[model samples]
Target: MECQVKANPQVKEVVWIHDGRPIHSFMATGNVEDSEKGVDSDLNQYQSVLNQRYRYDHHYQQQQGPNHHGSTIIMTNQSLVIQKVHRSHRGRYQCVALNDQVVPGCKANQKHQYGVSKNEQIRIRCEVDAEPTDDLTFRWTLNTSGTETAIEWPSFTIVNKTISIATYRPESSLDYGTLACSAQNKIGIQERPCVYSVVPAGRPDGVRGCAITNHSMNTLLIECLPGDDGGLRQHFNLEVYYGPNESRSSMKVLSEASAQSKSFSSSSSSSIVFDNQGVSAIQHHQQLRLHSNHSSSQPNFLVSSLTPGTTYTLNVYAANAKGRSQTVSLSAMTLASPEKHVARARDSETKLTFFFASEQEASNKSLYIRFLPY
Candidate 1:
């Protein structure tokens, strides 16, 4: 690694910085008369003071011995040589010349936008970078519709001389806007503050492209495409409804009391049956409810213990802290069990019989065999 320096004022010293820390430095070795000959006398005075404040370790010099092979200074002090360089040597490298002062700068390690609920508090953090962090201070501001206001104390805290945390809450619509944080030191305040936009949380978009992937006499496999989360964490829900295959008008109507009484146990919660006025008064079933934290490669649901040869209306909904999304509906039917069959054969002196049983009969009954002369 090499960093060449060419300055009119004759750089008083050069420091090699790696990952925000000084690793090595090269100081000019000459008489006072040679160092005083510079275009800017004021800058020369500043460099003298800076050299006193900023000190470099002699670790690099010690590594140049014959027993050491870590890092060493080569032909010129401007170049650095590292033996057996590996992953540990990977980082930001900077060549800093002591001539002027720099102002503080800050950046936030968060997304540009945040979804906030009404009266819900949120915390934001900022990282400040500057020389001489001893007298550093921080300030926060809120900007809404071209109007900016300073955030008072008790809402922000500074830690470790480099990080700042601010707590904020949006009470009304006007509080939704941009929040910014800045740092200041003995040199000067930051030119630009770290900014983040705040927006209101909303209902998630409805699931899409739902279809019955596979079905059997008592099970069905359904898959759907997920939608946007509406700037917040969201969950999924599947509702199953069973009704007759006839027209809507001819379908049977169930009383509210009867619908509520027909509740079944499930993994998440007890399922319930309800009736809609225009449509058939079908029996509703909560097949599955996945929480927001539930993660899967694909949004799929396997519904079991369903009735065979039955038509069902499936509705999928997405929900978040704000509200639930519109329903994405799909109509599917469970396969009907095949009928049983019997086969018989007779020879001159013997008889053979075969019986194929239906699913229910196979589960409930046992096979029987008999041998008799024809």
Candidate 2:
């Protein structure tokens, strides 16, 4: 029996299967002299059972010389020469050609965590990247309570030969666990499976590391580090509130000065109000809401039309389908605009000098003087 295979990239190996099992293998080392030595050990046992009556030969042919080719022609032949025909050899035979084999790498197309409610069906997509995409197969498994159960066909559908979507419904607490997907091709099965966690949806975690990144006379740029989404999509909200400075004297003066100004009310439950005696009636300035299907690692909010030299409190909250997270608070003050200054120079002097106060005494501020001849 002879089997021939022709492939690009050069065939790396040839395997002979009999009765749905591998009976012999040959490593196509590309060297004609080493063809006999490439026979794998798997053929030894089979040959012994046949009393060494079978002779195996691997033949490689190159139709044209290396330098004289329009296209290099390569072919491999695996022949099982039987000295005498026997009834035991009457079985199906096949030859498989293999180039470089690649193990499939699978990953969940959706978020790492999936939110599910009881009796709600969710379709999770798994994608695989591998070489030789033909004949690829996928396997899904559900692991719950230390027992892994294999999910058979009809539960999942394959699309475009590389993506598989598995339909799963969580009817009880036991159904909320981990779903893993693995893939295999003619080469081998994937070593690691793509995993996704299923859990009850809830509010997202509060934002962290809130800080005033940029501050001007009329605008404040606030940035915060995002947190987990609690197995759901999350958005961010920023609320700005202004009140008297933390100083007792400052609060008293501002309250009295602004007593005649229009008063504003806030519907936020977490609003902080300050009274006349420096007790923290904060007026809600404005609210900015950002909606995003995917949250970034660091989200920034720009609050404009702010009052200069006034201290304001900013609250950031993350909201999801379930609810909103706890408020993360940050206090920031916009820079005061510079006041006009007039300077007079002496008759004999060619330039006038001016001075400004530095907010922090320990700050390393510099002054530069450039004199141009008139």
Candidate 3:
């Protein structure tokens, strides 16, 4: 509260809310023209109960400085003249006439900020001095290249002190463009980026889909789901384990960016039952093989039947923008028989379907039918 309000001393009072509650009633009383003389005008002035009571209540007798009011003084101005002042004078002030009248309070001078961990995990927050105590808010945006460009750490907060906040990243924002979060108060605010650089992750943060099926006792056609952002990767390897022994015996398909189905076919014939209550089953073969860059429609094999009934483990790795990712391991056991299955033929392909074995193998999210050469 510094500038002297340009008032004809006509308005009765001004009101503002605080902590979900309204300020107590106030009014300025007495005459207005001789305000400098400390006398209220006959027009009737508004007054507010200062934190302290004026020692000399008889208008002309009360001291000009602060009074002993109920609330603590946040600021104090000792300057008698309104214009000849410095920053040190503003403090808890109370004006009492017959009614309460005043200008907007000092709540319009605060700000807030936020932060995040790896993977764009975030924590939004804000901070400032203090006014009448209100709330705050924040917002963010992205750039065309999919980079987070701007941010308003906290949205619109109506407060001045420290602001508390929490936010979550959209599970689907693979693009991760420029983002901004803005923290707003009554009339003032501050902002920051949700992320400084909207750097596209070299490796896709999302990718899923790879299950096993049975067409033959020795072949396992595993359909894999690839990522759209990352095309082909560099440096890939696979490990196959037969029974308790380790070996390499499956073909690798490097062209898959989304869903893929490759089979591990072997010449040996036997039978290897599945476990995990059919949730998953692995076939072990004596060998592992990588297919010769097949056509677009060919299945990517992890193991090509070097020996049937032998268990094996597959370790896969792909290149990413950040660098190289650790290999992912999958377990598989070659079938006991030689009935190797492949792709399916459908006149009306409803969903992505693969021909494995018996209709019982069909999945809810996918179709696994093992029948004639579709």
Candidate 4:
């Protein structure tokens, strides 16, 4: 950043100001040295002069355009490019002609903070081209990329050599790179950066789901589209939330099925049958047992016999290469046992007339009757 300021010619001396503060001033005008030599005064001498004569001041705040009427710096260079810069070089700046003795420095430079996305652990970093001894300050901007213009200074920091900031959620992931980090001191300002990205603990996303179905008093088994065709295996983890309370749920690990592993990526559409894969189990009221799958040994669970009268709620979630399906909920209720049948037999000396009583137990189906000698 840089600029040029014209001399007043009548003022005798020239001075630069930023936001009502003095940048620098010179004693009288026409200060250019006509006779200078020695390859522009050795690099070391030039460095010494720059450090002593032009050290920047960090206390001044930036002034918006329409600010202070005119350009402030007297600059001969096209642009002010700082190399290996640090966080101490941030804020609005101006260059003014100080009696033709020095050129103005640069244009205003703004800085931003860096951070991770929401629900994420990754962190961002900052760097600059300054001495380690410079006492740098930091300021961050939030909601920089929203629909509305959210760019703001909001606050600033002054302390040790560096600043580490951890932003809270809702304020963390603002959708774009709008946040600015301003590092300031008496001479200049530099800003560090922050980026936001959320990552779950496991499986890329740590949301685990489940569902129970097909129940008998002894067990409950779930039939899912196979995830692993014998080539792959999976287990069901059940965390039961009982009654009406949600947080009161206890974790119950249902059994796993070890069918032979087969991959869905195999060139066959049938390889994708496990698209119905899900977690399953059998409680004391519902038990899940490994059953023989003559079809393809693709591990499928069996729900065993269950108790009558009790209502059981089963929730099932299915997942595969495509993605996880929504949870499926079901209920099972047991029925009462059937009574045995009794009949009178005909005696050898007496002919007996038989009367039939109607009791429906799968009576829509027919039954066979036979007589044998005692």
Candidate 5:
């Protein structure tokens, strides 16, 4: 490969070296006729190499103009091209112009934006290019809020010559900010910066202790304990199904039912049961209610306008910054009104027998004996 290096009159001699060993050298004495004689450098050490334009100038008219009287001269294209480049040649190389005049060059890939999470490990690589590459050293820094902080050894590990890896734990005060890698030599230092952002969280854990509490003919109360909030604030949603059963078809009907009669009670602990018999039965009414705004401290919900004597399957789900959790379901049936049972008992002949029904006697055998005036 051909490598062209610029040259100035002050550059009396130019030497091509790889890995601190000389490959070729060109000595300039300011004369074009002596250019071929000045190439006294060795090339047979590794491979065949050549040099061009290394001589001293005696007269100005012979080179540029008849009247140009300058002691020093400037040479344009000074190149060193290799034939059939080999993998072994891929290493630090330098084109030394005048022994003590050091020149530095910087190289690095373009910085890109990366998405990361808390406590994640990341690797960054940067490169430094300079004449006499061994003269340079590299280090990294972090920029936070316009403040620059140098990276230390144990906190970040160096990989090979140009790469480094570090683990970022946001909990630590030192881990947050943009990253920059700097290359420094005797001449100067150059740097490259990278950008990154944190990714969103995942779904939270499920809620616990989800169960139905006290209820009247038209309202029901439910309570639950929220689990892990996925590192963010959480809210709740309650879905009620009151169709034939837990089948998908019944759930579809429940999904279509309007919640115009549904509402949340201001009381922390309350019940929900429907006063309208048509809406209370499984065959006639299906309703789905949602309650979004509630305090995490008090997870008790008072659902209103529910049907009496009808069973409902209620599901409570919690949501946070990430997503919603799996639903917790509970079933409860509202109690039938006592006034109808009292009316039926008055219509019966034996007052003692009329006081109790077969279904009621089977469920609750303990009778409260109360005497009424004759």
Candidate 6:
């Protein structure tokens, strides 16, 4: 935030006051004093507050104006620029000029707060009356730790009079709090604080390694490993698609054929198709009920009432308050019907080999019959 007091031939000194307290004082003779952040010199008795930082600059360059040369020259800058604004900047502000009897009006800007993502850059501004006095100066402060502290390098940088910007990165500091800027001179100070809050970054990457753990003639147990949750609590969704055992696209036709499975019901045997990519190719939807004791890295889900000797495509998703992650897929085939088993006896030894519908059916199972005579 920036505040300025224009200096006239008659004005001698300008003081900025905030909350009825004098913050800084500027003089037409090119002298500046900051009671809170200024460096102690032989001419000033105030101790330098190193933790409280404020900056002062004088604009001496000639600019086009109403003078005979079409330029307005100044002896002092009489301007205050806050490099960064925080929550502590809120308060009543008034600028007072001494000797010249011209008092600069001071009013605090509206108190406002902003929400930013991690590593986002934010800027807060303060504006003060800059009537003819040339003795006004600006100061900036931050109150992230409950106490007002001087904002410094690496986090804050000066933009211009009335504007200061700061960057907050999660890897660095965790403080996302208040910023303040004050306009002042020897007479008084006007200050206002702005609030700022930082939210965590976006949702995490998708889950990994979705595969089947166990399955029976009518049931299956699927497991997967989920990635980060974007710093939020997460849950897993297990989607199952069952059909006349057709292609991935055919599952949609199967779901359309069975309207009773419109929503997921524990008792429903029909599949429910979802619409995220091909993940909707499921015959049923089930939220994986996980115990709190279980780690989020690995989640397990159980599917029930599947047809004997049938194939199912499962898509799992990890979601949080922010959003859902990408889908991880698992294909499973149920065991053959008990009636399909045929027992054969050879020389008092028996061999068992289960038959499957196709090569794709064989790949979906964790166990294949071994040809060993027992």
Give the candidate number with the greatest lDDT: 2
Q: How well does each candidate superpose onto the true structure, as a TM-score?
A: 0.42, 0.50, 0.24, 0.23, 0.30, 0.30
Q: Which residue runs of candidate 5 sit more than 4 Å off their true CA positions?
A: 1-200, 246-298, 340-374
Error of 1 at 135 (Å): 4.2
Q: Please, what are the lDDT tens digits per residue for candidate 1 over residues 251-333?
A: 45445434544453323233232223323333333433321122233467888888766666666778888888876655566
For candidate 6, the TM-score is 0.30
Model 4 lDDT-worst window of ten? 27-36
Worst 10 residues of 6 by lDDT: 45-54
Angstrom error of the Cα, residue 233, model 5: value is 1.5
Mind giving the per-residue lDDT tens digits that candidate 6 earns over 1-374? 22354443454554454444545443222211233333323213211111122222222221122212222112233443332333343455544444333223334564245444556655544445533335665555555643466473245554444344554444334565555555555444543333344435456567776566677898887777778767555787766665454344444544454564456443454345333233434433343322112223456877777777666666677777667776655556677675544332333565668788999998897774567532
| Winner of 3 and 5 under TM-score | 5
Superposition error at 344 for model 3 (Å) = 33
Winner on lDDT (4 vs 6): 6
User: Between the candidate structures 2 and 5, which one is better when assessed by TM-score?
Assistant: 2
Q: Model-by-model lDDT, in order?
A: 0.60, 0.61, 0.35, 0.34, 0.48, 0.49
Q: Score residue 109 of candidate 3 by CA lDDT.
A: 35
- Cα lDDT of model 2 by residue, 1-374, tens digit: 55665666466665655543454334322222233343456566544422321223334322212322122112345554432233443456555555554667764455667897889888988898866678999998887753566454358899998889888888887778888888888756777888878887778898887777788898888888889888887888876665444333433344463453344222353344333233443333444222212233346787888766666666678988888888765556676655311122233465567555756742667667875532
- Residue-wise C-alpha lDDT for candidate 3, range 1-374, written one tens digit per residue: 32122334333343221211222233122111122242233212122322221111111122233332222222122112233232322333333322222112222332222222235555434333322234544444434343445333333333334443344453444544434434444434442323333333455322234455442445555444444333222233334344443322323233431122234222332113222123223333433343222121212343455456544454444444445444344555565433322222334356654565665665535735665533
Angstrom error of the Cα, residue 140, model 4: value is 1.1
What global local distance difference test value does model 4 have? 0.34
